[model samples]
Target: MDIEIIAIGGYEEAGRNMTAVRCGRDIVIFDMGLRLDQTTLNEDADIVGMQVADLVKIKAIPDDSVLKANDGTVKAIVCSHGHIDHIGAIPMLAQRYNAPIIATPYTTELIRQQMAGDTKAGDAAKLMALKAGQRYTLSQNLILEFVRTQHSIIDAVTPVLHTPEGAIVYALDFKLDRTPVIGEPPDVARLRQIGKEGVLALIVECTNVGKKGRCPSERIARDLVRDTITTYEDDKNAIIVSTFSSHVSRIKTIAECAHEIGRKPVLLGRSMEKYATIAEQMKLVSFPETTSAFGNRRTIDRTLRRIMKGGKDQFLPIVTGHQGEPGSVLTRIATGDTPYQLMQGDKVIFSANIIPTPLNFGQRHLIEARMQLVGARVFEDLHVSGHAYREDHYEFIQFLQPEHVIPAHGGMTMTAEYILFAGEMGYTPHATAHLMKNGQRVKIR
Candidate 1:
């Protein structure tokens, strides 16, 4: 048996996740993602005209020179979710491969939207939608299986590649949330069945491995939102909440809570509208009929002016910029770029965590300081992570019991922590636990 795994990216850094697996002559690539820190900072003057060489210089997307060397050997490009860190680079890098890009319905929709935004990418991408749990044969020796998984985004999946060597599971950016607000729980039964059959290697994420316990469920976050909104319902000032736009479940919870408190739920931002519209079209989550989404600058300004004319307390606006992006709706609102003003005692809920990068820290500090100068009450860290924590990793390892494990989706320190945690589960380094770096290759015989 000959199976080789290549870490294209996402091993040395926290983002830009891409991995290539080769079993004999067939090669399959999983997750062409982006590094948000680089992509967000470098404002692409023309994404459509930007060449792959330019993107490589900025390191916004993975350097897929290794995969490109194989050319027509690639059978498929499979994506596990719709998160930018996992699917963002598809628009820029997917055209390099001759294989069809396969993903779940919602993820496929997002890729289509990204391609549509860029004319060059529009003609380059060839996407095929496959529902979770369905098996698609990529070649005579390879079958692709998607296991429905719980994550921050809608329609996230765990891809299991059934090769002649054995079964290889790619479990990245997921949590075992039993009580999710919208999607079904993690498909543990399918995972266990795969383990029973046999698993050659398990490439899992180590994003939250430093954390000790299981990550809290989305239900807890919904309850927190409910309590906070209830306590501030009688306030006369406007209420604004910001979170990850791709978090359809969290967005749905916030919308429902706002509706229950007798306030109109308004989504204001380009990304917020993009994801919400796709989820609605896919019938994943249903917002109230009264909920309104504003996508462009003109529409957002007009809607904010209307809200300002009426009592601000009558509307609950959910915008983007949880990471304090420069041009996002939250930053514009804080900087007085919008028509509406954040007055004294107005509520601003950050339903997300600071991503802990230097750029993010500085940007968030600026935004918070600006909001404080205007005397707005800020509530932060009211969100739960979508990645599995250390305990969840241990449980998943026990369930899979694979012959070998490769930790992905983190930096060296985070990946080290996962290695230590896996040691506690009786996996020895270099024997069963393989710690890989970007551009490194490992062979399983």
Candidate 2:
């Protein structure tokens, strides 16, 4: 049996995560995502109307030139989760191959929403919703199984491809959160069963391999939010919280805390509305009756006016722009571009971290400075990462025990850390632990 693995993206950086695994003539692609920073940088370039060639030129999407060589071999495009960095490029790239885009219900819904807004690519896209723990046979030689895994987003899965050679596990973008706020824990039993069945090779994410110990659970974040909010007892000041819009669990926790503190919760901004609507439609989480949500600018303006009139102190505004995007609601409110104003001692809780990019760091700094200038108190980093840290990586390696390992979903330094960690775990480089580069291919037999 011959298996060739190619890294189309997500090897050199954190975004645009696409990989192609070929077993003989049949190929399967995992994750068609975008480089969010690059996409944001080129937002003014009219990406929607630009040709595929021009989008590739600007690095907004993955360069699928290699796949063009083996055009009809693609059997499926599997998305691991609903994060933009993991599924955003589907509208731009999935139609290139005449294969169904398979993902969980939430992920499929997100892709459909993304496609609906893109006139250039939405008309031709095909989607198939596959729930976690279900199996789908793509061909006589290949079978796909999705193992439910915990992450920041809802319905995350780790796909295992059962081939004639053995089982190949794609374990990207997951964390072992035993105490998750919403979904079930990672399916450790299924992983152990696959390990016993003898995994041929395992491709895993290394986003937080450099950090020591297991990442904190989402429950801890909930407690932090509760404690922080309760500290302002009867303060009667505007309280705003910012986080990743895709983090439905965090949003639920924030809403719960807002209600507990005698304040109504309101979700604002386009992405916040999009993700929350998807979650609510799927019944993953439900907001309280007092909760209000808005997507469009005009509606947001009207809602803010109502919120201010009813007393901003009685409402908690949960918004997008955790990374401080220029046009996001948080930034607009901070820059005095909105009808609502920040008063002295008003609290802005950032329940997210800076993405460690220069653009994000600069934007966040500027927004914080502006908020401080307006005499608003800012609190940051009241959250934990959704990726597995070093100890969790060790636990995952022990659980899977694949013959070969490939580190993915991070930059050079992060992947190198995984390589060293694998070495320490007794896996030899090049022989067992494969260090791959973007667009490079490796053959395993």
Candidate 3:
């Protein structure tokens, strides 16, 4: 029995994450995603119309040569979760090899949503809903177990691969959130059992290795929302907020906070509204009543006009564009495209950070400038990360106790930074922790 890992794309950078786990003739690919780089993707360029041809040219997707030997040998394509950076490349890659995609309910739906317009290949995927802790065998050589974990999104999973050589765990995108907004915490007992039984390797997310402290629970973000609402309770101003669409927990917190402050919460983004439907379908979070919806610029304008004319003073509007996407609802509104104008002191909150990219910071500055020009009070970074920090990564290493740990989901700098964390934690056997790039494969036996 043998194990092979193809650290495609994102293993060395911040996007286009695809990893292949092979046991003899049977192979499974986890996460066929895209990398978002404007210099690479071209600023002002949209991805919706972009096909695999364009993606390969920009090197935004993984080099398919890594899967050459195992092309048609794929038994299953297990989706670890539904973040675009992890699942975005699937519509183009899933059909090359015939395999049923296995994912949690919400993730499966979200993937379907992502592949909406790609009729040429979207129908080829056979998506099977995987419940947490359920084990499913794909072939004689490969078996998969879905272990639940907490992330910013709902129904995220860790794929435990059972091979003849040993068990390989893919803790793809997970945080130890005991008190999560949508699902139960990670299955620590199962992970420990696998470690005791002997794990060949563990691939963990290394997004925030150098950062300190455990991630605040999704509940803490909720509490922050509650506190922010209370802090501004006396002000009779319209409140507009923006955050990650997949952050159902944060949205739930904001909803509860809005309810407490006696305001109707109206979600106002296309992605947010689309994901809210799936979140409710998965029972992760439910939308509050009296919430208005508008995704398009024209509709948002009409909705705001109605809200203003109706004299709805205490209103909480949540839109997209915190990362400064120019076309997003918030930017359009702040730029005065909306028929209703905000005067004096309308409150606008950004529930996410700027992610520290120069382009992102530049865009954020422009958005802030627009908001200030309109006399809107802007508040930013009222949030926390969804990934585990330095101490938490060490704690996970202690718990899993795997023979090898390959840090993933970040660039060469982040990868090197994680190497320091491992050294401090006595994670010797650095040879076992393979540093790889797209098309690179590591053999384990």
Candidate 4:
């Protein structure tokens, strides 16, 4: 039986990361993600109720029509992490596949929540929770293994497919974080063992390949947030922070710092409440006792009013909209649409980087300008990237030492750069190091 690698999505751009590894008659798919940069929608846009065809037309979700054309059965739909770019399309697309959706425990909960919100898809797809360092048999020829890895979010893993030929590793959205704030470091010994055992094909992300060094640890982000927030510990002005709601470690850090500085950490916005609350509920993370969360516009606005009435110095509002997404808490507050007023010298801290899209940059710029006009002091880049960088990729490639390489989870330029980098390591393009685009397929003997 021959093996084939299919680039269903994410080969064209940074988001919507879906890939299929076909082994004879059975196929294992990794990530049915959504593209976050839909021009028609804002960063916080909701496509939950949207049809699969409409979302595909707008490039908001992966066009899995190509999968329908294949003859093989989809044995499993595996998600690497809980990020929207990894599992956002599940609610709309997973229903089409008559297979179990396998993910780490936290990611499984996230997917369950997403499916619960979309009744049309929820009842059709089965959900399976597979923890890291565990294995599940998909078929006689395919055994799936979850290898622990670090990223911006908790419970992220690098999935490996064990087949008769060799092992196929899916290393999208991972980082070699030796000192993560929340979990143990990447399973280095297990990865090295897998490398020694023999890897047939390695599909990896090239999102941060252009960056020169290894990605910084989440510990550094904690330091940056702590140093920044504690500097104004004595200040009486409002301190509003915005970050990726899914980043549980960063939220914990921000909340701890707020508690340390005698301020209650009030999580606002729907997503802010969802991700953090779920993480807390699972015992995956614990925030300060002073931390509170509010979702929905009415409750959020009411909470903001309470903050305003209770005095700004007493609370730190950790909100959404670091990308200045329309309708997010930070955006609403910045535009004076919320009851929480921003006074002169009030702080707005961004614990995330702009996700390198025209829409994100423009929205971020507009909201920053608006906040500055109100005399709010803005702090930026109090965060670290979750994707591995150039050296980290090099290290990963060295560890796996796979016979074939497929550069994925990036557009033309980023993927091409990985190919070039692989060339220096003696990987011939198309022969060993393959650069693929969305909807393309390559066969490996």
For all candidates in order, the CA lDDT equals 0.87, 0.87, 0.77, 0.91
- Give the runs in model 1 whose Cα sits over 4 Å from its true position: 41-47, 68-72, 122-125
RMSD of candidate 4 to the truth, in angstroms, is 1.2
Residue-level error in angstroms, candidate 1, position 64? 0.6
Question: Whole-model lDDT for model 1 versus the true structure?
Answer: 0.87
| lDDT rank order | 4, 1, 2, 3
Every model's TM-score:
0.97, 0.97, 0.94, 0.98
Residue 89 in model 4: lDDT: 90
Score candidate 4 by lDDT: 0.91
TM-score of model 1 (CA atoms): 0.97
Query: Candidate 4: lDDT of 97?
Result: 81
Candidate 3, 1-445: lDDT as tens digits: 7677878768777878888887877788888877766333321223666677767768787777667763448888888888877877777777777779888888889778667746645563488888888999888877899887888778888998888777888887888888886668888888778878888888878888878888888877877776776676468777878888777778877776777777787777777777776787667677677655566556766777777876556677777778887777777777776665766788888999887788888888998898888688887778988888888788788777777777778888887778777767666634767666667777866
Best by lDDT: 4
Clashes of each: 0, 0, 2, 0
Query: For candidate 1, lDDT tens digit of each residue in 1-445?
Result: 5798899989988888999998887899999987778766422112566777887778777888866564348899999998877887888888767789999999999888888877666453478999988999999999999998999998999999998777999998799999999888989999999998899999999999999899999999998888898765357888899998888899998999889888899998888888998899878889988899998889999999999998898899999887778888999999999999999999999999999888999999999999999899999988999999988998898778899889999899988888888888888998888899888888876
The positional error of residue 151 in candidate 2, measured at the CA in angstroms, is: 0.7
Candidate 4, position 410, lDDT: 88
